[model samples]
Target: MSAGDLSGRRALVTGAASGIGRACAVRLVEEGAAVVAVDQDADGLAELAKTVDVEQSVVDLSQLNDVDRLDLAVDIVVNNAGLQHVAPIQEFPPDRFSYILRVMLEAPFRIVRGALGHMYAGGWGRVVNISSVHGMVASPYKAAYVAAKHGLEGLSKVIALEGADHGVTSNCVNPAYVRTPLVENQIASQAKAHGITEDEVIERIMLERAALKRLIEPDEVASFVAYLCSDAASSITGSSMRMDGGWTAH
Candidate 1:
């Protein structure tokens, strides 16, 4: 597609300080969209702002009221802000679980709700949720993340059905472990939790299910998001596209 395919469009991307969200913001900007990059990391946001022409919002999405108050009237909304807390259900901290749900599930709902009216009025919008393989299947020790993503999957489909007639499309992009700071930070914890060395964590735990034994790149996922917002993807809604390197093909 042409670089200016999305000229005149505006997009809101949560968790835009880094990782997949940052990549999405950069990609959309390259495609000629004005991006509103929202995140709690002030320093990261500052760096991102210098790299791209985007409006930076230093807001914590875990605060639902703050999310509700944001100006969400944009043509594209990417619900990519999420955190992972791994522990057995019996041992999981209730507060952490609640916090995860609030950020990952409730925040997305509010953001999408805030933007839908504008989308319907304009008769065009794209909602690309950064979901995970956990959205489709279960894995051990990720009770909250799994639950939130599954809820997001359902939410995306519902939005798809409700917005289809209005020219709005909602979909989820599920990727296996992406090479991001989030995943890198989890290496030590995962190794300890699974009783393996850190070196073995990626091969044994993260990439074990995938035919391709490597972590996905942030830009690769961003490319998928960009395509979903393109004219070519008009008919692709309510779908969960897997960039899992054959993980789900099993």
Candidate 2:
């Protein structure tokens, strides 16, 4: 999509305080979309709002009730909020598992359901859910995160089908390890869980899983999502675009 196409469009991005969500929000504004940024970090959200024409809101996506207010009327909704709590199934806390599912899967569903209502009313909208390569295939010690991401992919598909008639397209981007603060934290957690160094976690656990053997840049993922949000992607709903560096191809 071109800058002119997004000039008057309004975009709401969850988890917009940092990492992929922040990058996506910044890119959308650059593309000329009016942005509403949502995150749990009030300070971070404040920092982001200063630079852009952003309406900032503090939200804990894990609570389903948060969606009541998240459904701000907008032309685009990017469900980029998620968590990575790494632990073996046997050792994982039940509360942590539920927490991951709530934020990564359930919240996205609520956001999409609410957004679709507005989208249907307007007759044009884009729903972009940011998933992960773990949604396609998994490794050791990321059960909850993997399950939630996998579930999110399924939810996006259903939304795509149901929203089709209303001219609302739903799609997901399943990216490989991106060098964002979220993934940095995940690497640290993995290193701690598996008794490996952080460097080893990135080189062995993350890169080894990717054919590219490198971390994906946030902009790479953001660009694809921006495209999906465009009129050019009108026929691209109900699809999972893999930015996984051929990890699933193997």
Candidate 3:
């Protein structure tokens, strides 16, 4: 309840079996908050549970019904589950677009909408959405992803204004191309889509816009998320915190 610690807090983190979500689960636990790890990957959740004492919820967030089934009474909600599809706008499949938005945007909206009551009652809470650099800007061949992130930013802002009096802060952490399995998969997809090698995808495409010239590790982003969740950042609501390696500096 105080700055720098989460002794009695409970956090619900989606996509928690791996990548940034996994790192967040570990870090928040280290900060003393109990975590409920949610993901569609049953095997990965089992693996994560083997290492940490977390309640595992194996639900496909794309399934709105399953999202509703989740125990929504928690002090923190980290909406980090996502996927990407790279294609020119004209070639983008309508179904894929809808699917991405359902998982990335609609699911978060539902989770936060359901969880707000408990947070408001408790008079304290945090909603840390793991958005991407695309949330602030855009890139070719990622129409659906870009749209979903953009929507997420707007959702965070609205939540901030409404939750301010209730002590619930909603914010987005925008990082550029993190070193995660998702990004790794994107590299392969990009390489094929662009007719280049994976190394070229990383160097000439992914890192091209980033001044840091390297991928961001999941722990680094997770650390920032933990900070936002801490009492130290009670004033930092409805803000988009970018860890984009100066990608937006352009």
Q: TM-scores, in order shown? A: 0.97, 0.94, 0.96
lDDT of 2 by residue, 1-250 (tens): 4434698788999999988998899889989999989999999898888877688879998877866776478889999998777677999999999998988888887877777777899899999999988888877788998899889989989988999999999998999889899889888877998999998998887888677878999888888888998888899999989998888886
Alpha-carbon lDDT, every model = 0.94, 0.86, 0.94
Report clash pairs, candidate 3.
none
Q: Write down the TM-score for model 1.
A: 0.97
User: Tens-digit lDDT track for model 3 on 102-218?
Assistant: 999999999999999999999999999999999999999899999999999999999999999999999999999898999998888879989999989998988898889889999
Mind giving the per-residue lDDT tens digits that candidate 1 earns over 55-74?
A: 99989998988998899989
Residue 246 in candidate 1, Cα distance off native in Å: 0.9
Give candidate 2's TM-score. 0.94
Candidate 2: minimum summed lDDT over ten consecutive residues — where?
Answer: 1-10
Clashing pairs in 2: none
RMSD of each: 1.4, 1.7, 1.8
Worst 10 residues of 1 by lDDT: 1-10
For model 3, the local distance difference test gives: 0.94
